[model samples]
Target: MSKTVFITGTSSGIGRETALYFSENRWNVIATMRHPESRKTGLEGRKNIDVIHLDVLDPDSIQQAVTHALTTYGSIDAVVNNAGYAAFGPFEASTPEAVRRQFHTNVEGLMDVTRALIPVFRRQGHGTIVNVTSMAGRMTFPLYSLYNSTKWAVEGFSEAVAFELRPFNIKVKIIEPGIINTSFYDRSKDVLSTKEITAYDTLVEKIIRYEEGNIKKGKFSPPSVVARTIYKAATDGSWKLRYHTGKYSGTILGLRRVLPERTFIGMMRYLTLR
Candidate 1:
């Protein structure tokens, strides 16, 4: 029997790419997204792939998606928790709803999905969980307070859970992608702003200009690179905890470990916000 993988946020970007990669590799893919109907063009009628509706914020949707996957594939070998969004800009500028939504979707949502799948994996005697965290989880940059916080939460959660799940024959993996060319750069990211407060306008403008300048010249990895890393994590059969993808992910993470805290902060500021 072919192994099966369930992936979230498969409407586009890394999620979509992962689905395609696994399908091409002959693994049955339960490709799910909030609006699967909109993605029918390239995905529908494809072999070994089933597009389903799954919104991480919706518990019922999560359960239904998992149930459908099990029913269709008989067993789910792994799950890729790639459903998340980013909120950028000053923390003070963010609305209460936006802040809640950020954690709810990124942190709480990931937990909910994992919680739902744990029982199935436990019953099966083995499974793999690949979380799509970010380089921001271990490091930080200006203008991404909420997004960084969420990814940091995921990093800690995945690391801690790996120890607990190992005895159950289940592995938890974290994929930290640095900067990838995806809709996350635009459509999938929420940029927060406070209309009434202009105090931080200059700082925000400077940061945006600096970041944009780099992006124009940035050598971003394609989403396919991340998909390959995820595939490796799923099939490697090792309890290895973290996998870094994208351009300079390994270099940046290495520097974070060797450099003093203040020195790393200074370097990041000079390179990004200066």
Candidate 2:
């Protein structure tokens, strides 16, 4: 029998690609997003795909979507918690509300969705939880302190839960992707307003320019790269905890692991502080 996988944030990017990938590979896909009406990723009418409305910030909606998937698909074998937003700016420039929204969507929201599936998976005796974290989760960058906090929390959370869920045969898989060519650089951006603090302006501008240059040069990988990695994590049947995907993730993470802390930070500074 073909397995079923529930995915969030399917309106675009990695989530959409992953949904399509799984559907093409003969898996039932619950492709969910805030507005399923849009059909932006064009999953409608596709084989083995069900579009769902899910706002990660809404707990009720999370449960509702989970219920819908289970009722429609009969069983869910894996869930991809890809519904998250990013907030970028200096930490000092971040507002209380911004921080709350950031953590609520990326951290709390992911937790809520996962919590909903735990019981279902427990009943089934096996399941996979795939979290799409970033390379920033392990390594920091300028002007991404708020975003960094959420991803780091996810890494820690996933790691702790992975150990806890081992007895139940539940798997927690983390996907750490480097910058991918997604609206994350555009539509999904939540840049903190820096009008009050002019101190970090020069550094922030430098970093933005450096990043824009990379995007212009096509250095980032596409969403399909991440989708492929996610598919591997879900179907590979390994208890592996982390799968680094997308461009430059392995290189950057490997360097951070072997290099001294100060040296790694220095290298990061050199890249954007120019």
Highest TM-score against the true fold, candidate: 2
Report the error of model 1 at residue 169, Å.
0.4
Question: Per-candidate RMSD vs. true structure?
Answer: 1.1, 0.9
How many residue-pair clashes does candidate 2 contain?
0
Backbone collision count in every prediction? 0, 0
lDDT of each: 0.91, 0.92
**Most lDDT-accurate candidate:** 2
* Colliding residue pairs in candidate 1: none
All candidates' TM-scores? 0.97, 0.98
Off by over 4 Å in 1: none
Tens digit per residue, CA lDDT, model 2, 68-165: 98888789999999988788888899899999999999999999999999999999999999999999899998888888999999999999999989
Candidate 1: minimum summed lDDT over ten consecutive residues — where? 36-45
